[model samples]
Target: MNILNKTILVTGACGYKGTVLVAKLLKAGYKVIAFDIQWFGNHLKPHDNLTVVKGDVRFPATIPFEGTDAIIHLASIANDPCGDLDPKLTWEVSALATMQLADHAVRNGIKHFIYASSGSVYGVKEEENVTEELTLEPLSEYNKTKMVSERVLLSYSDKMVVQIVRPATVCGLSPRMRLDVAVNMLTMQAIKNGKITVFGGEQSRPNIHIDDITDLYMFFLERPNVTGIFNAGFENITIAEIAEILACKTNAEIITTPSNDPRSYRVNSDKLLATGFKPKKSVEIAIGEVIDAYEKGILVDKEEYYNLNWMQKAIL
Candidate 1:
């Protein structure tokens, strides 16, 4: 299952995680095929050993699956703000596109298929460590579609070596930088406004670094012996705790508000760790990296705020 000799197709290759993962795949010497519609519905660049396909996943289309070893389906309009932008568009792309991908990949003899699912698929995992077997209670429209997407991908399990990973709220530095994440937003507020405001500061959330997230995908891709579901979070901390971490680094005031924001949960990534996947980054690391970038003037804001549609993390 070495990636060096394999050919893999990663959907939405221009995204925050996708771009970073694509770079890693190339470094691993995989014959990488990147499918994306960056802007104006076009695949921007061409590289040696890399092919960019410009098309929408919502529409049934053919890929160069003849000798492809695997498919990492990372394309999706993730999050409530982004998905709610256009409900019709979200449904078509997220759920419908996923079904087409599974059906086509199997028919094309693609043996391994890795689906980029989310922890949001399980709306709230209360007391116990949330595992693959937890009952899903999706609160938002975006989450509902993701739950459906995972189910559809699972239906093709018998044909393809399907592995589903429900990653926690991803944070960390990226070349395609974003400030929409809870951690990133707090960092920005602490730096510019001198204070960070948080809603439901007591709400516990599962967090993971961006690099750790990419590593998990590659790990699962190479390990065919491991199948089924796994959670992808490192530390379980509260919202207030996240702000406190940034405050220590940025030296800003923390403002708390117990809003009925309706979001809280903790994840158990023990299953993923059992597969030799140990996350190297933490909330502190991510907060520090971002704060450093801002203080050093490397990531000064041209945009007043981050938008779900623009933030590359919105790509599941």
Candidate 2:
């Protein structure tokens, strides 16, 4: 599918990954409709090819879908912590609303529907490398919802070209920066306090740079043939390993603590790689980018930068 002249609607357009994906689409000459509740303030600068909409994904009837060639659904109760806060809200936004949006897109004759699922759906596995075919054992409400949503989207294969990407924990700087994610949180802690905390650092974590994942979203947008579930992480490194790298770069002491969060799994992205998708950034490179942002005064350690903190104040 040639997305050069296509109009794409990106839900959660104001989010960390959403903001990056929206910009990439506009730069590639695709008309972009950015839909979000703006729980976070709008960070995107206005563009001629961009149309921003403030609305919830649960109400697909109210969101304009006419002339939309595709839909990239990203809006959600985001992470494990947020999901734990309200499982009902998580299901409504992440799973139920996603299924509703896909149904609506199909009814509107939308050609492609890409669902932003998470690698966390793999759950706490002892497996060295989890793949798309593996039975999902989602441990958290957040991932459970994503798993449900993926199945729901794929059920519409006959009606619309459905694709589900289980993206790894994304790290890197963005206009709408998030400090809650692992690499970002560790980098921020190191920069701000000169102390890096590693909670049970042996657990494996699959991660992809923010740019790489967002670019993958763009790649799937135009490549209609690549449909189905695919894991999108480039590297699987342990928490201690990540902290060691951050310590070397930031000169912070590694403080170890028994982990309260034991979720861990190494993901295999060979399937995604086979599609000729090359990840351009690495965890080390993402670490450097976060440091650069700090040096430039672009990002700081604040409640606003952390999702859980902000959501507590912003939501209920």
Q: Say which candidate scores most in TM-score.
A: 2
> What's the TM-score of each model vs. the native?
0.91, 0.97
Candidate 1 per-residue lDDT, tens place, 167-195, comes to: 88888776566678787778888989989
Worst-scoring 10-residue span by lDDT in model 2: 298-307
Every candidate's CA RMSD: 3.1, 1.2
TM-score, candidate 2, is 0.97
Candidate 2 at 266: error in angstroms?
0.9
User: After superposition, which runs of candidate 2 have C-alpha atoms over 4 Å from their true positions?
Assistant: 1-4, 260-263
The true-structure Cα RMSD of candidate 1 reads 3.1
Clashes of each: 0, 0
- Candidate 1 segments whose C-alpha is farther than 4 A from its true place: 39-46, 302-305, 309-316
